[model samples]
Target: MQVNLHDAKTNLSRYVEQALDGDEVVIARAGKPLVKLVPVDSTPRRRQLGFMRNQGIATADVKGDFIDDINAMFS
Candidate 1:
């Protein structure tokens, strides 16, 4: 679907919905195609838990040290 710049601006939300629905949207200026609208991939990536489990870092010691430092700060 092709639309003129003024029409595209006037019906921006409709065009965006059409684009998200997988329809090809083209914006034109003086009948010349200027840009295409497409939906972005908005999915967030999942973080890997326990990524440092085998990295030789002691989790319990780190937690204890952090708590001790926080207690010292508040004292």
Candidate 2:
């Protein structure tokens, strides 16, 4: 839905709710489109317990060579 800047400002909360409900909101200035407000996909990420429990221990073998490791990735 297209709305003027003034109307968008006045009913900002309502427009936000509409966008969150999967409706597209277009804010216009002088009949020209300026921006669009759309809903972001907010699907919850799965919870994984202890995914990095031993990662730090594995890195202990490295002796202050973080910069070399990073540069090797680029090369």
Candidate 3:
């Protein structure tokens, strides 16, 4: 279904519900199709912390002057 920009803005939630129900939504501007609203991937992307934990990222690897430089710049 297609909706003009103004009406789409007013009933955005309703249109989003429709899209979530597997209906294709096309937003238009001056009768020209602009964008499509579709359902997003419900699956959450997997993530882990400490990307550099094993990449020689210990405190000994950090520059000794790094903290002093940062403090000097911020203070």
Q: Pick the candidate with the highest lDDT.
A: 1
Candidate 3 weakest ten by summed lDDT = 57-66
**What order do candidates take by TM-score, descending?**
1, 3, 2
What is candidate 2's lDDT per residue for 1-75, written digit by digit as tens? 999999999999999999998898999999999999987777999999999887775545454657788778899
Please list the residue runs of candidate 2 whose C-alpha ends up more than 4 Å from where it truly belongs after superposition. 44-75
Estimate TM-scores for all models.
Answer: 0.61, 0.55, 0.58
lDDT scores in order: 0.94, 0.90, 0.92
Model 2 residue 70 distance off true place after TM-score fit, in angstroms? 32
User: For residue 4, what is the lDDT in candidate 2?
Assistant: 98
